[model samples]
Target: MSAPSVPPQSDGGQSGRPGRKPGPISDGVGPTHRAWLEPLRTRFLAGGLTISDLSERSGWAKSKISELLRGAGLYPRWEITHGLLQVLEIPTWPMRRLWMAAALEAHKKPDWIDGCIQKVALTTGPVEPPLEHQAFTDLNRDAYTAYARVFLEDQEAFEAVQETFDLLWLHWHEALASSDVVAFAWPVLRERVMDRAYHSEDGHPELTHAAFNTLALSHLTDDDARFRQIAESLALFRAISRLPAPQLDVMVLTHLLGLDHAAVADVLGTPIAAVHSTDRYARKSLTTVLGPQHDPGDAPA
Candidate 1:
């Protein structure tokens, strides 16, 4: 069967304009949509490609393309989305995951999503992951999993790591060209972890839940001492979570995961000097909140 045709024009003329704004996306799939749409938009704009250009290249109507660009109308099928992605020169494999995630959020069943892929004849035969990509995953997966587990449960943390590797596999070429693979991959891992993290009112990841699981709390046996330690640890963990991203990352690697500054620099793909500076900033920030007596240096150990 042929691919689905464009449905009725839904965006009026608002979307086809040169000065484009993203249109409303379905609430359930909004995050996944932006994950796919934002990169696609950046490439589209960078190439100076028009809806007409995309229509001619991708064989979709300008109206449909506009709606897709603005994220208006129905959650689109993978077939059309894939076509536009090709025209925009976005990597398809990584995007396939994002589209599938959005489709699931939009309540599409796994079998139904698979059927859509089959209908479009888009399935490529199974292939092995690149050796270098596999090597990277093998080396970093455990440490990354440990890092993610600070905020996530085991299964969630494992899935977050798996998703990060899948993304690295998809963009392995671009990642290789980057200054450091860790530098390229770390943010992606963080994004996946944070997506599942419990956020506070101010939008930082909430560590209260994770704080109770810390080894420091687990070792204290006396009820009164445990209670006091819990109070202290909670305050420190909350402060650690609220630090700016760079500082927070350094703190987590250095204190919680037991990585030294040199190791953290390697893991973060940052210079040792920068990691040291960020770690110092994090300590000062924590001290400012919990008092000098409640130094995070004592807690995570």
Candidate 2:
């Protein structure tokens, strides 16, 4: 089954534009996030579970609960969301895990990592401080889970996240030395995945089975254009994965990691020209695979 459809985040009032489209909240996944969370909000109201009840059960402040429900903060924390679920006597173990997974990703910037970055990024490199300079802060369950989801799927991913952070916990100072922690997250997480995939010798079944250069993929299904867009995105990602390693790496660094050409060149230890060439090839191949006149407007906003 498909996920629920979310209404536009804005009605274009803020932009003062008549026909401009609404944008996603973060990573262009706002619709999916709102779709799942909104229903829970509805249930909370329908069940007559007031702020006092949730506050009493969860031990979180009423203002915090109110802000979360109203979508006031960066993103709702999983613990808070889980607390609300328990207040409603809902079981979160098996079925709601997927929904919770999606909700948890919103926790990335909201939690510990964001604050530490400011302190660490200001410094040139690792430096000894007045015995009080902390090496690393803790990773919450939500952020830990999202890190693994960057690569792996299901139970193995969970285990990988646990093991990976435990190791990172060993060398926390290195993260503190990075020029940009936001940029650092992608590589650090992906390296853990690369290690796991290499050590265990697991094959990427998704890429082997996926097809991008097909007309059927290019054509939107009549039943639901929205759903078709989601399918196209999956296909596009898979196709990118199947590109030659250099091209794939460059494309992923540029688009997926939100890196600039200079950063890509730095990461890959390649010249700027190679970065440009690889990106050009990647785009041209994707455009061909997506078919002539394939509009990327349908992609996430």
The best candidate in terms of lDDT: 1
lDDT of 1 by residue, 144-245 (tens): 998899888897787678767766665677778778888888898888788778899999998887678778777788999999988887888888998988
Instruction: Write candidate 2's Cα lDDT for 236-292 as tens digits.
Output: 766666676567666555665456798667555567898898888877887888774
TM-score of each prediction: 0.80, 0.33
Query: Residue 202 CA error for candidate 1 (Å)?
Result: 2.2
Q: Give all candidates' CA lDDT scores.
A: 0.75, 0.49
Record all residue pairs in model 2 with backbone atoms less than 3 Å apart, i.e. clashing. none
Segments in model 2 whose C-alpha atoms lie over 4 Å from true places = 1-149, 153-191, 195-223, 294-301
